[model samples]
Target: MRALLVEDNDRLAGLLVTGLRRAGWTADVVDSLDAAIAACRTHQFDAVLLDRGLPDGDGLDMLRALRDAAPPPAILVLTARGGLPERVEGLNRGADDYLVKPVALEELVARLNAAVRRMRGGRRGPILVGRLEYDPISRAVTIGGVPFDPPPRERLLLEHLLQAMPRPLGKEALEERLDSFERGIGSNAVEVYVHRLRRRMEDMRAGVSIETVRGVGYRLRAVD
Candidate 1:
């Protein structure tokens, strides 16, 4: 998935970008709040890793601005400020999740995934659709209680589709949701992922079908 990393510390920002990449995310690093706001306006990201302190202004303000937008990206605030009030204020201002400094990379990734999952209206954990269940945290999918393996990108694509089940999502819209702000994906990549995912579902006898809408895009329909 695509992400925005708003951090002023150059070293930490680099580390965060590399770590996010390893976790199947493309992240754009910005050191200032203005850049963060501009990036949010110009690009689409699945999530934003926001640091509360920035060079230009408070990251909380940026978070508030993002929340006020027509369609704000999911936000996970990263800060060294461990005060209870700060955490409470961040959540009250619409932050999806929060992580203090010195957090393990794995934990940060987990938090980001959870934030995105909730932003998509996913349940508390793995989402179940018909005979298939997908765990966003474990990055695992099971059909009929048997494990089904798919590539990471395909798994993420399936998660997105399953989250939007029964709703027809235009192809372009799907791409934007899957895209990270660091790199632009080709138009056909979404179709390619969907095609592969469809075959996998069929092979596993999963009672879920990805329906195509011709000029539109796709949707997941559960068959009981």
Candidate 2:
């Protein structure tokens, strides 16, 4: 999953970004509310972790603006203010969840997972398509009950495609979800990964295929 971390504290932001990447999430850290807004406007993220206090402006205002924007991503507020009213206000402003400072990395990951799960309408865990099953928490994929070892980026690509199963996802949207602010991705990188994944799935005799839309994008479909 791709996430945006809107925290002004440089040290804390770095730590959180590292921890999130280790847990299979690509996180982009922005120190100011203005930068955060700009990031949200330009890119798409699976979730956003907004610190209530930013250097230039209130994080709550940023969150409200994000909620008002077109195609808003899920927002989770991270703050030191662990009071009743503060939490209430955050939620009222469209924060999906609130996390207090000095939070455990594991808990933050779990909460983020829960937020995404809730947003997906509480779908059953470990997405299944044909003979393949993908577990986001474990970051594992198994085909015909046998595990296939795919690199992290490949796995991330597969996860995104599976999440939007049966729907055609344009190349631009796929790239937006896969690229991080810190990483430089090639224009044809998505095609390369999709080709690799197709071969692997074929080797495993998985009853699915990644279909190209010819000038549009791709789709994951079950093959009879």
Q: lDDT tens digits, residues 32-133, model 1?
A: 988988988877777888898787877888766788766678898899987999999989888898889999999999888888777867765677887999
Weakest 10 consecutive residues of candidate 1 by summed lDDT: 176-185
- Of the candidates shown, which would achieve the greatest lDDT relative to the real structure? 2
Write the residue-wise lDDT of candidate 2 on 112-222 in tens digits.
988877776775678788799888656578998898777667778888888787788899888887789888579999999899999988988899899999888998888
| TM-scores of the candidates in the order shown | 0.78, 0.88
Best by TM-score: 2
Looking at model 2, residue 163 earns an lDDT score of: 79
Which segments of candidate 1 are over 4 A away from where they belong? 21-26, 83-97, 113-130, 135-139, 222-224
- Per-candidate Cα lDDT values, in order, are 0.82, 0.85
**Clashing residue pairs in candidate 1 (N, C-alpha, C atoms within 3 angstroms):** 2-180
Shift of residue 106 alpha carbon in model 1, Å: 3.0
> Model 2: what TM-score?
0.88
Query: Model 2, residue 191: displacement in angstroms?
Result: 1.4
TM-score of 1: 0.78
